[model samples]
Target: MQNVTVVDHPLVQHKLTIMRDKETSIAGFRVLLREIAHLLCYEVTRDLELEMISIKTPLETIEAPTLKGKKLVFASILRAGNGLLDGMLDLVPAARVAHIGIYRDHETLQPVEYYFKAPADIADRLVIVVDPMLATANSAIAAIERLKQRGANNLRFLCLLAAPEGVQKFNEAHPDVPVFTAAIDSHLNEKGYIVPGLGDAGDRMYGTR
Candidate 1:
């Protein structure tokens, strides 16, 4: 995939498998999502710029590498995105966060924005959009679009699973924004759901129908 990176690490894959099982409890699903997010977060942020600065160690003074540039922002696409956001925060504690409230109209599968909030200086920071499933890509696309309108140029999309159709559509819509996912599933189903997907991520995590 040109702009898409699949995180195929054993831990990520293993946790995803457990998440996909229908019998997994809500608590278990939430825990696994956070764990997988930690693993995936590692891959997405692997290329961050680092600058060396002098630091005093127990025995001597040494120059240590630390992240360079402004703090990155994590733009979450509503209820489900929060699941991934929790773990991503665990990895990047200082990263800023943005919440975009967009819900899928079950009938049309279109994204309808209800609320959006973020830092004022997003234009000078890297924004990583987190949404667990990219089945239709409607919400993710809209969320990124809104962020760009707010001056966010450098951005990336992170998801736990993606459908082939969703991935292609997302790339076409935002070629400049790269995508990172744990797995690319078969395809989207009739109701705009990903086949072999673990079902509605929000519902699963919240124990809702």
Candidate 2:
């Protein structure tokens, strides 16, 4: 829990409860995920550095605060990650995006990479990796490794739910990157799903189940 920050805002908790209900419609699930993503984004980027810049107002020109570094890069991990990405984008409209296509091989519980696309200047920006669940952490770990191979140094991992096992593995693998999550559930189930999680995020978001 050293590098983790849980968003416990009342609105976030309320929305998450609705998302966890099995009877919630697909449309309702998708909307809540996006709405919660906005609140998560606010907390995750709370300490981003700012610098003063000159700006003109009706009265006079004055120094105004602006983000200090290059636009943040959001590295979304495959299908489920996109759900959170939609909401994150709603808040940070100018942030760059990276889509990493990797899925867990259900048998081995390992990750397989199929596609990757991102801005050329990824090395210069702060990369925030988004995924809906971090059960095994294999996919998230693999995705971050791929991005680091492309020269990303500053990074963070954001997820809607995380299992303690996955968090331990992730911290052991990439200690430098902090994790921001809405909740850390009890544990991972036998099939690598988070216990008490709202169910398969991809399935819920797309009606795939």
Q: What is the C-alpha lDDT of each candidate?
A: 0.95, 0.95
Off by over 4 Å in 2: none
Candidate 1 lDDT, 60-107, residue by residue in tens? 999999999999999999999999999999989999999999999999
Q: What tens digits encode model 2's per-residue C-alpha lDDT throughout 95-137?
A: 9999999988989999999999999999999999999998999
TM-score for each candidate, following the candidate numbering: 0.99, 0.98
Superposition error at 142 for model 1 (Å): 0.5
TM-score of predicted structure 1: 0.99
Clash pairs, model 1 backbone? none
Which 10 consecutive residues of model 2 have the lowest summed lDDT?
1-10
Q: How many residue-pair clashes does candidate 2 contain?
A: 0
